[model samples]
Target: MAAEPVRIDDPADPRIAGFVSIRERDLTGREGLFIAEGTVVLRMLGQAQARANGFAAEAILLLESRLAGIAEVLAAFPPEVPVYIASQAVFDAIAGFNMHRGVLALGRKPSAQVGASLLGRLPGTSLVLAGCGLSNHDNVGSIFRNAAAFGADAVFLDETSCDPLYRKAIRVSVGSVLTVPFSRAMAGEAMLRGLAEAGFEIWGLSPRGQVSVAAIPPARRIALVLGTEGEGLPEHILASFRTARIPQRPGLDSLNVATASGIALYQIALAMGRVA
Candidate 1:
């Protein structure tokens, strides 16, 4: 396949608009598009491409000199996807940061059905469902990555949680975001009820909780409930299920949500003999 590269000299070129103000509200808020940086993430995105599921690659931006190599990497993509080449300086200007590897791509958000169906298929599964106030994308991504790596069956995000596909979350997950199945729960109450109805024993992770996480018995299916950094789970939500906390040192307040998730997931996996 011949590599066709379009030279973009002007930063303001309307064709490259997706690459602008990625950190600001213009692109994220208005268009709901987030930027993914580095070659590894871009490659992950390419590998996870699905045809029937609204997978659309808008553009690929690369350094002028690296165009050939990038073209080779992108050879799998159809001809309709635009490939843009720019000088390192121009690429930096457009990306609003140093172009780490001179490669980036614009991808559409997968539909909510993708997540919903992914969760529904896994019956009697142990998983993580992030609740309200956990807004950090990196933390959310890390939790997802750990969930997948540690053998958690799926993930569910509450209404207040950040988008798992957000660029920062995706990058932090090291692209594990694509591998892990996830869905959104409109309210914390609904999430808890659904998991209970699905026959999962819900375990809430909190610092002040009475029972240690290790005490929770291994079950056929479990749902680990994780809340935000400072506020923890609301009273009503806490009252809805059994609460468990990671044992910690005398002075330390608590573990970060992601770290707490990893420990809890490891324990569950170990109990099931899934981890050696």
Candidate 2:
């Protein structure tokens, strides 16, 4: 059953401290917790909690007017999870902005797992996305969205990559960050080597790649390695891994990493029999 809302009279209420000034704290905030905003994201968070895969909703804050609309969503979560409601003024003050969507959730990040450990656990047949120096949160989110769309088993990130759980990234991904399994590795090279050791055929995506993405054959396991936007996959990585290109026109230098990921994932997924 959906828990009855507890009205929040004060914007500075101690019970809702975690939600204060979300914009400022998003830049430098606590690690174990993340804000899940919007009805879609909150719904995904509820789904994540149902999975019980090391994720939980610490609390939910809503504009008093929105409680009725999200009743189904609230019902998905356990009654023990507190639901806090606030008037427009209090909600705006607490969030540091006019939160039009008015649906927000504090979700606990799952326990950390080492990159190699996560890679080692995947089944023999798997498709994965490996990101190197992908600092853009939106790109990170899109990558996970693409991975999930293409049925990738997991995503691996290097230390230089941005956290997918960043508020904007999570919204950009429409909550795929919470759904996809991901881990951060110490180094890009170490991540690639670990995937290789796990019997994953690693393919680095680069404009200068030797083969076209469509030409690449199927494999038992494949990891599509993506790099940052302008300065693409490092030369060393390009040299080390078998690379594939998207085959674009002469005027264009390269596709955005996120767009490139989606295209590559689609093609590779088809080859790997993950999609029709």
Which candidate number would show the highest TM-score if scored against the true structure? 2
TM-score per prediction, in order, is: 0.88, 0.97
For residues 189-212, could you state the per-residue lDDT of candidate 2 as single tens digits? 988998898899999999989999
lDDT leader: 2
Predict model 1's lDDT versus the native.
0.76
Per-residue lDDT over 85-166 for candidate 1, one digit per residue giving the tens place of the 0 to 100 score: 8998898898787866787788766666776675567865465555566788889989988987888877888888878777
Q: So what's the TM-score on candidate 2? A: 0.97
Predicted structure 2: lDDT: 0.90
RMSD of model 2 against the true structure: 1.2
Q: Per the 3 Å backbone cut-off, how many clashing residue pairs does candidate 1 have?
A: 0
TM-score of candidate 1 to 2 decimals? 0.88
lDDT (0-100) at residue 114 of candidate 2?
34
